[model samples]
Target: MRFQTITTDILVIGGGLAALKATHSASESGMEVLVVSKGTICSGSSFYPLMEALGCQAPTEDPEDNIRLLEEIRESSFQMHDEELTKIYIDEIRDRVAELPAMGIPYRKMQGGRIPCFAKRARDIFIWEDWNAIRNKSYALLKAKDNVRLMEHCTVIDTILHDDHIAGALCIDRQGSLFVISCRSMILATGGFGDLFEHNLNPSDVCGHGHILALDAGAKLVNMEFIQFIPGFMTPRYKVLFSEQILGYCTQVNDAEGRDLLARYLPSSITSRQCLDERSKHGPYTSSDISRYFDIAMMKEINDTGCEKGFNLSYDPKLLEDKREFISIYVDWIRKEQHIDLLGTKHTIAPLAQASNGGIVIDVRCATGVNGLYAAGEVAGSLHGADRHGGNASGSCLVFGHRSGAYASQWAKSCDRQAINTSIARKALTERFEHHRPNRIDADELIKEIRHLMWYHANVVRNERDLVYAKDRIRQLYEDFNPATHMSNPKTIGMAVKADHAARLSMILLECMLLRKESRGPHYREDYPEKNDRSYARRLMVQSTADKDIEYRFT
Candidate 1:
């Protein structure tokens, strides 16, 4: 099939904070921007915001607020993050948030003060509960930009190369139309591979498109080893609802119902201000030493009391009696937040979802090793090194997305247009589609198996054996991926490529994680329980230097 073509000054792929910021910055700088979406604009991981989330705020009144905030995220990153990149995002975080309200994003506010970053708030800071509203507002703003052209419901199959530099991308519409969008520069704000895990909070659409695209384009990828496994948020009944309640309330539910069921992880000295210690790294309470802080006998008694109480404190309004504001919040959550009936019940959450800690290695300007191509958001591994800070994801995406967009636009303006050749697009996309020729393996079935494989091997707990098993399974999947019917169809081919892309991403990260013997933020190993700064202190990246199978080298 011949390619139908459209050209633009700058091409922004993936529609979220990163893509929106990039497109908007380029357009505001007087460059035409064509922004593409993998799905609806307001979907994916960023769609569900749990309260303020990020704590990137600083005021003259609070002398150490900014430092403290930076310290928080830095700690999460295990001090492995790029200092400049972290600082830049932190500096412009509020600027990004301020833009949201101006764009009509809904956020619960009080006396004109907006919600501050992070789930916790001490005093006069604006604490917001409405996050879906924020996402909608950002979407509205992006939709309103004149220079920005929004193309929803599209998937980029592959890049069309010109003299080895990226000239454009080939995409397929929902109705299976082959549309080639040519541009001098491309910005990939494609999110992360969190959907690789079955129980992740990130939406399923975020299946590591950015990593695969960059790999095919020969861009160097780094830190694929560190996939962040969030510690808190284990709900009993639901299939991993967010630990958002704990984020606001500083609560921790049962861990697979172990630890005597009532052994508290919190230290005896904990107050309202000190509650975060239960969840923090330096926190006195932990899974390894559960009995250290809690009296086992007391814990058993409390567990019995909690059981006799019939409803877990999480849902029971009685627990909130002493704190009416908290009661109101609980009432609102029970009434609005949780879909649970007002009838009190105990909810179970365990390591709710995985967050991506690292991916492709990009520089401060969001440029990867490949020229004429830039990656932002989760795809670009610049901000978070070992583990990501609480609110860094959205903030970094907004800040760097804007920077990458501006740079891409500026570069596109100077480069003279070479007629985009159609041969490259057809060949690249067709070969990709051909891999999925249908004989058997239903896309649905294969996808489910892959998810389970990742959940068992790659998510939260990891050891040498599991990681090895995961790598071998991924290899088998790659081999068995052949389809029998309509094998050469473009739509089928693209979907197959997506599966391959996600699988490859899992293998690459898992391989790197397996190689790293030390335990870090997201890449925890049961064998090496302690964080070993001695050997595995540096950042890790896996690049396909020569062959299809990746080779790892540190960055």
Candidate 2:
């Protein structure tokens, strides 16, 4: 069947903060913008506000507050993000928040000259009136834009390249119809790849399609190996993501052995709240002081004894009862309201699984090496080198998202149709159908096997031998690609393309993980236990040089 074709000056492939910013900037720049979201913009990974970890009491209005905090997080990302891009969004985050108020978001703010201390540390965290406000406001912006087109439940399969220039995109709608959308410039804001792991605090839709698209288009990637795990999101029965800001400040009572284990982990230099330095200068300051620093692998053994004790010890029921019934209601609300199947078995959690600290390579303009393509939000690798600070993520959404879109729109405005070719898009769509037909692998089985391998080899600890094992298994999975393996009755040719895009994302992370040998901030090496800042402090980049292999270079 002949598919429908749409044309715009620019196309943004995500519905998250970055895509919204890019679409807004493109329309504001007077360029026609088209946005295709994998799911409803509000339902994707961005909407899941893991607020328990926040130590803030209220949001900050200080103009300089966002900028100062972000510089610190960017320093954590190993100074890879452009300083120019970092400053812009951090400077404008308040406006982004304020915009929400106008969009039916009852933004929480100081009433009549009253400013409550939102968080314990004003510099490290801020309390949103409501995190859900972001999801609600974006709906209004989509409604108001005259030149902006919204394509919901759509997947961008690949780019259309003509003479090495990205000309347009190939997309598949939910109805099994192929659509070719041509745009002078494209902003890839499809977010991160947290689903590559077995248990993820991230929404499954965050498959890092933006990064994969850029790679296939010949753009270089940096630090794909570094997948930052938040120690708090222990899954199975509950998906409670305790805030880093709170843990960095408050005291944690780990009842693994019928009592708090934090006492055993506490060191001589500090005790109680003092042990967690609010002014921690580095990502993982002292190895013993970092996240999951004192090993609690024994806690798993303790978790098994919970069934005999009555109350499951993996998660602290005291957190719900003590924090309040409101906390329980709020946690339950996320599951019922958002379809997060996190309530099954009692699970033990450490401070892990927050935001991804690594992603695709981009300059101040949010452009990868490939022209006409840009990345933003969590998907675009920002300033979080080894680990990100508590307040820094909010800064990134404000900063990098704005810069990527501004540059994408400006680039779109200057281009004509001369550089575009729609052929590459057609090929991507056709190839997608080939992979989805009838398959033996179920999504559960495929994901389960993938999670097991990744978690075993690539979590907080890593060694050279296990990483090699990870590589071999991943290559085998790709060779035996099957889509109908987990058919949800929606398996059509179009969905195959999305799966292809998703698997490539997993591969990218594994490839990058294999190259980096030394341990850094979030990416740990059990074998290379020491941080050899001498040879590894520089950013590691993977460029497509010859044959399918990446050529690694340090900057």
lDDT winner: 1
Clash count list over all predictions: 22, 26
TM-score of 1: 0.81
Writing each residue's lDDT as its tens digit, candidate 2 over 1-555 gives: 345778888888887666776667667787788889988875545565653322212224675655555545465555545556556555666666555444333444322321111112334233343556556676876778788889998887678766666688877778866678887888888877776666566776776777767877888777676665654445433444533322332334445345655565455565645544331222222232343343323223333343211112233234334333224444565456544432334445542334566677777778886778888777777455665544455446545666777888788777785433445554555553345444545445555566666655666666777777877876676556675342223345444445555555665566666666766666666677666767777777766664655566778
Q: What residue runs in model 1 are displaced by over 4 Å at the alpha carbon? A: 49-73, 106-140, 231-241, 244-277, 280-331, 341-343, 432-440, 483-487
Query: Candidate 2, TM-score vs. the true structure?
Result: 0.77
Find the number of clashing residue pairs for candidate 1.
22
**What lDDT is obtained when candidate 1 is compared to the true structure?**
0.62
Model 1 poorest ten-residue lDDT run = 283-292
